[model samples]
Target: RKGITKVTVEALPAEACRVTFELKRPWRWTPGCHVHAYLPAYSLWSSHPFSIAWAESKPKAQPLEIEMEKIASKNGSLSHSADIDHRPNIVTADSTYSRKSMLGAPTVTTISEVAHRKDGVNIAIPRDSAVTSVSLIMRARTGMTRKLYEKASASKTGTLTTWGAIEGPYGGHDSMTSYGTVILFAGGVGITHCVGFVHHLMLQYQAGTSSTQKILLVWSVPNTEALEWVRVWMDQILRMDGRRDVLRIQLFITKPRHRGEVISNTGSVQMFPGRCNPETILKREMAERIGAMGVTVCGPGPFADGVRGAARSVVTEGVVDFIEEAFTY
Candidate 1:
């Protein structure tokens, strides 16, 4: 499971990151399914894991993509080098270290080559809001590898030894195939799950086998640039849908450079130039919009809690159904 085959720069949010890989023979995955991503080695045998962010349905094309944020690292110095920003370090038989020592420090050891494989587990990304399928958002730690840590050039994510992991396509509580509407809320990496889930749902809607679920996406990010990664794809999808009146997209920037920059002022979405904790969401009219819609939340705990609390009040009235996918600890 330790091998490096190719590295490429792909699109995502506001950032484009270097995606390195070595797909094993017969590598397989679905469009929304993600695998455990491991960084280069640290010591002789250590690596970190992150989610395989792109759709893996097609086996003929590139298999991975990392949505890189374009911000330069402020921590690339001999003194700041002490930070575990980026370093290729994966766990292997030859690798040796402890949890404490590897916490902030991860070192990379170059190999002649790298190889990777699945332990035999594949997951299906949610394609519909059916009772049988669930939309889950779980998070795990992954080390930043050396490719991300560029002391000379600060465009890449700081290289580290580890990153994050994901759970499964496990089920969630929703009405059914004819839910009629799907609205998703995502902040930061939470957008990861939203992106996959929306792709799945929309595809079903277009096939005529499912209800024409109106899609409303409200994404809370720090800036518009963050949307750059998926901009191209979203544009393509939007053009294909030809149902603008039904699709309402709101991009909420919690840290906009100018004032009054919310994508829309009437919806549950609001733009701010500061933080977007659960408290900020609590202060909004999310409950009203959530009424009669299948509201799904994926973000940190606080944000999820905020969504849950607001929806709980309305759910008792049978206005909407709320499902939260905690993307972080």
Candidate 2:
């Protein structure tokens, strides 16, 4: 947990970026787990928590993926220095300073400049990966994240390798193996969580280790760029063994680049335009119930609540469990 890792940064659309961390040692985690990252140099010694987006167990392979979003710091400097974004003097939600201090000028900073900070974009962890190898998909916002983004963008090559620290592959304990039908719902980056489960369950089903006979993955993203968030991972899952036989994926793009871009495959994978209606999708799946169904949601509060309500309405239809994976800090 105290090892230093090398990170490669690649920018993505929607002000987002991906950071691939190469661990110096081995690491392990379950599908829903996360890790705490301590970028002491970039973040004023503050450690932030982010969900592990992807991981692998191969020897010498990078094993942890963390998706990050850049948050704007209120009074941070944007001078573009490698070590200039640490704003420990500002008042924040968790700071000891009172609310009045938050409304006034930062006691330590006289100049107001835009700087990027890091924020966690909640997502899923890849299954069966060594704790040491990982990747992070993140969006650039204000202080540390912005600095990181600028550094990556300014890189002569497409990648920027830097030093980073990782701790704790935490909280992926929920399991869906006991259910015969498993339905997963995701919104935006939340699809990251569901994608790993799809891989885990599919492999288990193929090996006769899981009771899940049917798996349905429903994901809602804003646009094609957002789709790129999990394009590589989804591509891999689509090609998994017996994927078409046991798995079905439905992608709903709330905002499409073009109406024609909302395409669909005739088989197990389908794409549609507009937001996903939780109740409607739940009702349809419950109508064609398999064995004991498990409904898991990882997204916004409103969306999760809608799914929870939908799952409850159909409880009498069969044995259904609605598991929500969400946290606030």
The 10 consecutive residues of candidate 1 with the worst lDDT sum are: 108-117
TM-score of model number 2 = 0.75
lDDT of each: 0.44, 0.68
> Lowest lDDT 10-mer window, candidate 2?
107-116
Candidate 1 — which residues are off by over 4 angstroms? 1-34, 41-52, 56-178, 260-292
lDDT of 2 by residue, 264-327 (tens): 5345767778988888988898888678999998887887888899999999888999888783
Best by lDDT: 2
Model 2 global lDDT (CA atoms, 0 to 1): 0.68
lDDT of 1 by residue, 9-29 (tens): 332334434243423332333
